[model samples]
Target: MSVAGVGEFGLIDRVTARLTYGSTVLLGPGDDAAVVAAPDARVVATTDVLVEGRHFRRDWSGAHDIGRRAAAANLADVVAMGADPTALLVALCVPTDVATDWVEELADGLGTEAAGVGASVVGGDMSASPTLTIAVTALGDLGGRAPVTRAGARPGDLVALAGRTGYAAAGFTVLSRGFRTPRLLVEAYRRPEVPYPAGPQAAGLGATAMIDVSDGLLADLGHVAKASGVAVDLTRDAFEVPPQMRDAAQALGVDPYAWLLAGGDDHALAATFPPATELPPGWRPIGRVAAGSGVTVDGRPFEGPAGWDHFR
Candidate 1:
């Protein structure tokens, strides 16, 4: 069938029917907004919009990659607040020529990532557009615990993180170097497997402040620093990338630190803990909080652009 023959709703229906809405969905798709049972006192909500050619390229990422990334990015925000993701709503716009299988792959990707974070896609919408765009809203529950916001960090708090840094950036570097995606870096770029459990773990360990390293390490940590009215110092010397990244950076003639410190899309967890608090497994101590504002690297001002912005 031709693009003109397969309309937007027709294509959407084909993909949507395959999705299985979870039991918690009070009002699933075909609504203004899907209603979910918020048993927890607070519902952690986050939304992210990924534009084709900006957030992703069809040439670089598969439909599944786009879906996974779209879901993971928003889900990471809920995790940053130390909340457990419960449900997700996705809205997509695609060109008329887009294939039905591509949409299914996107849904599969979304499902894969959502399931990884203990959530499911409850609702979505589809529309015809010139270029593809995906907007995802993730809802989470705090389980009666207060959110660990960026503003909660206090002076003397020890800074720690869960998950690797610079992998996505390194992957991008590899791509820019005309190299086909290597296994590690390709997976880093195609589908960032965020350490979803780390946020709740930090909260359970009494984390003072938390933020997802979606942007560069320094930039996202700077959010916590500014919000908490504390200074964050990262020991870059202690921040080591896997040997694969080292080789990629060397091949690209780019400083791995640029990717580690300023590259975004890592989706790592950055949190501040009290001096007495025990570090969570899979986390490493990287810095400490001081009675000041802004983020520093090795006790010095980190000289670089802030981070990702839709409109720079």
Candidate 2:
């Protein structure tokens, strides 16, 4: 049925009524603004928007996948700043003729993703548009810990990552090539599994600075370099490119380097810590902080696109 038939408030009522909230939310749906109890005092907030054609294709991704990806991207941003995601607010603009069932499934995916990060959907809004656009705002708590900002990285610190590197990029390559070999590649593109616990773990590990690898490793690390006024030297030899990616690279006859070094959207955590710091499980050291600006892969300037920018 068309959203016009249900109207705005009616649609919201129908959509939000199914949401299961966590106790942390003081006031949830049906409020001017959501009231959350961040007893931790410091809160982390990040926002992102996904346009249908620009960010994803409905034909290529399911409703659940879209919802999960949208939530994962923002939650990764919150965690990148060294916080625990506590709540999510999603604003959806969909064409009226869009199936209510699809909308419901999308909400289900959003709730599922938030739950994975120990958060929930407290509130959101819905409107009619010509295409699907999802705007997600994520709220996080610092747990009384000082935020590990991007600017805190220092020379002599170790560079480490807490999640898969090039899986999503490989997935995109497979999708473009019309080859159906690796299921992991497609899953990586559809639902990125961010290391939810690693952010807080890195903070506890005395991480000097942290960021999610939303852009390529070199590009995102450059963000840290610029923020911290230091350089990052990534050791490419440290990376063990998965066999699936190698095979996909062979199939496409493209440089796997771009996927590994320049491709973005994996939402993995990249952290800088003192040389003596101990890394948690799933974290891999791939580089080191240095005393200059810019990023080098194996001590050489990385030549590639800067990263994902809203406007190029």
Candidate 3:
């Protein structure tokens, strides 16, 4: 049934029924305001908005996947700061004509993904809008570890990455072209595989700087480069096209490196560590830090747009 039939409270009931509250939740859904624990005395919070046609399309993704993607967007940022995410407060703005069940599935996706990391959806509000929009705020605890920031990278540091890159961009390219793409490529866009433990683990292992690959690898790294004031020259030879996108790229006549360098939404963790420090498992070296400034592709200047632009 459409949300217009059930009304707001009824729809909220349906969504809340499916949630499984986590340990960090002192009070959960149905409360006027949720009370979540801040065991580390400092809370790490991040928020993101996913707008229809901008961040996602109804034709390309299911409600469940969209919900997961929305939650991941903020949760990944908290994790990148070297924290364990604990709870989420979501705000949903939906068109009256959208099915109520679709919203419920979205909530299920959010709750399920949050639960995976011992977190829960604590509370949220719904509103009517002309289009579908989801805004999620993720809260986390540092567990006494220093929050990793985009700064701290310096000369003589090793650049490393964990999790997949380029796949999401390739997937986006396929979807945008309205052409048939492989299942793996499609799923990469629909459901990103975020390496949950890697962020906190990297911090524990003394990572000097870190950021998630959201706006595109090069563009996002430029943040670290600017923040740390260190020149970052990424080694092109270090990246090997993943098996999932190789054949698809061949068929599409797209360069894999373009996606790796320019694609966003992959959500992989790129970090810098002191030279000679053994990288935490699952992370491999990709580049190095220099005493100079800005970002480089194989030691040369990158001349194009680094990644996706919201206004352009």
Candidate 4:
């Protein structure tokens, strides 16, 4: 049935009826505002919006995949601040002609991703619009540890990364070309596998700085470099390009490094740690912090675009 047929209240009830909230949520749906626990006396919050046609295409991804991607983008930001994800407040503006089941599946996707990191969808708002848009606000707890920012890296610190990168961009390329033989890449673009735990873990292990690789790796690292007032030099040899990526690159006749270095949406966590620190599990050393400005590959500027830019 179309959303207009279900009406607002009925649609809300259907989407929220079976959700499971974590302990951080004291009250969930069916209220003017949901209540969440802030045990650390401070809450980490971040918001992101996904607009239909711009951020996603229904022909390429279902409502469920769009919802997961939306939730992951915001949740990853909370974790990047060295906090544990706790709750999500999602607001949707949908066309009246949209299917009600599509919205429910979207809700299911959001709930599933949140639950993966011990979080819940506490509340949200809905409205009618000509275009579809999803805005998610993610809340997190620090567990009493100091929040890691992008400005703490110092010269001589080791740069590390948690989780894989470039898969999503590669997937986008394959899908755009009307080829999906590489299911792995396409799935990545549909739903990123963010390294949620790595954020808080890195904080506990004395991460000097951190960020979620939402924009390409080099672009995001450029932010860290500017904020921390340090130069970042990446060793090209440290990254092992997956064979799948190589094969795809050969088929497409494009440099795989462009995806690895400049692609976004992977949601990997890149952090800087003091020298001599034993890296945490799943974290790999990729570069070093130096005294200077900007980011470089092998002591020189990267040849292509570093990451995503909305206006440029």
Candidate 5:
């Protein structure tokens, strides 16, 4: 049935009925505002919005996947600040003609992704609009740790990465070309395997700086470089190109490195640590922070667009 048939309150009741919240959520849906526990006294909050045609295509992704993507984008931002996600507030703008089941599936996707990090979808709002837009706000607690920022890297810091990159971009290319045999790549694009825990783990290991790689590695790292006033030199040989990526690249006649360097939305965590510190599990050194400015690949400027830019 369409959302218009269900009406607003009825649709909200249906979507929120079966949700499970974490202990941090003192209060959930059905209130004007949610009251979440903030034991650490300070909250880290981040928000991201996904527009239907601009951020996703209904033909390429399901409602659930779209919800997951929207949640991951904001959740990754929270973790990048060295905090544990606690609650999520999702707001939706959908046409009345949209299916009620589709909206429910989207809510399920958001709740599931939030729960993966022990967080809860506490509350949200629904509105009538010409386009479908999902905007998510995620709140996190630092557990008394210092919030990691992009400005802490010093010269000689080791640049490390946690989680897969390039796969989502490769998958995007595959889908764009109308073939989906490379399930791994396509799935990566649909649902990024974000290393949620790696953020706090890196913080514990004395990570100097950190960021969620939503835009390509180089593009995001450029933010780090500019913020920290240091040059980042990445070694080409340090990254291990997956066999699937190589195969996909050959079939499409494209360079996998382009995907690795310029693609975004993989949501991998990139962090910097002191040179002598022992690296955490799931993180590997891919480059170093050095004296100077900007980012480079093998000590030279990257030859293509660094990463995704919403405008030009």
Candidate 6:
């Protein structure tokens, strides 16, 4: 069952066998390249690469989880830009010693997660690598709405968010400390619940600025702050820390606030709205924009290490 036994084409055939395509995908796997419909003539595209050991570990995650995480990371960006995800191009690099079944399951994970967002895995490539790596590019349709970039926050815009945060960091802590009581926190690290629908909805309701919480709250917000030449001040009490994080925090003997403030991979949508605009359903006000640089919590600057520094 090793991929080497089946060869590359055989492995590809096995992987594509279960993939289902939707209306957006004019053509799927098997051609030199796949064709996907761009209904708006403007495609919002984003790519993300996940490497084993760095982004995930086989011992800690299933092949399916890895695939889902990769897809989620890329797809969430498109949604953050106010687009409905349509398709994905996933290129995988795996060691020859890996089993073909594992690769196919990875495909299943990608296909299933993409289908959840009405997207298809139209095409990709395969290669041998020293370690397992997955690179996914997500394509989305803007639906005639202006793409929300990170650079539009005004001084008075209210910072709001949809979906919960800090679960993944708590889950990581649980696994690292060998605690097994809170299955919810642990599962969150293994598989995140990204608020995919929240993205376009926020855009529709006039979000002035937005981003996917790929890197922690303060850290990703820093990008928006720097890009928009503004400061984002978040109140400590504005975020309703989930009970799971509170319970996990008690077990870890550390403030759960760190996880909430600095954890990444939550994939929640953080957006800025007019001070008086009503928040969309599922969106909650968390902070406000100011006229300074960097992010502050309770009006104090964040001094801790920013989330997920890939090189340092």
Highest lDDT, which number? Answer: 4
lDDT of 5 by residue, 1-312 (tens): 999999999999999996888899998999889999999999999989999877898888998898888999999999999999999998899999999999999999999999999999999999989999999999999999999999999999999999988888888888888998589999999999999999999998899999999888988999999999999999889877899999998998877888887788899999999999898679999999999999999999877542233111
Candidate 5 worst ten-residue window by lDDT? 303-312
Candidate 6 lDDT over 200-248, as tens digits, reads 9988999999999988888889999999999999989987778877877
Q: Relative to the true structure, how large is the alpha-carbon lDDT of every model?
A: 0.83, 0.86, 0.88, 0.91, 0.91, 0.87
Q: Model 1 lDDT vs. the true structure?
A: 0.83
Stronger candidate by TM-score (1 vs 4): 4
- lDDT by residue (1-312, candidate 4, tens digit) is 999999999899998996888888998989889999999999999999999888899999988899899999999999999999999999999999999989999999999999999999999999989999999999999999999999999999999999988899988888888997588888999999999999999999999999999888999999999999999999888888898888987898667888888888999999999998999688999999999999999999877542233211
Q: State the local distance difference test value for candidate 5.
A: 0.91
Which residue pairs come into collision in candidate 6? none
TM-score per model over all chains: 0.93, 0.95, 0.96, 0.97, 0.97, 0.95
Instruction: Report RMSD for candidate 1.
Output: 2.5
Task: Give candidate 5 misplaced runs (Cα > 4 Å).
Answer: 305-312
Which model is ahead, 3 or 5, in terms of lDDT?
Answer: 5
For candidate 2, give the lDDT of residue 209. 93
Question: Model 3: which ten-residue window has the lowest total lDDT?
Answer: 303-312
Clash count of each predicted structure: 0, 1, 0, 0, 0, 0
Is candidate 4 or 6 superior in lDDT? 4
Give candidate 2 regions above 4 Å deviation: 303-312
lDDT of 5 at 154: 97
Instruction: Rank the candidate models, highest lDDT first.
Output: 4, 5, 3, 6, 2, 1
lDDT of 6 at 195: 91
For model 1, the superposed segments whose C-alpha errors exceed 4 Å read 1-4, 303-312
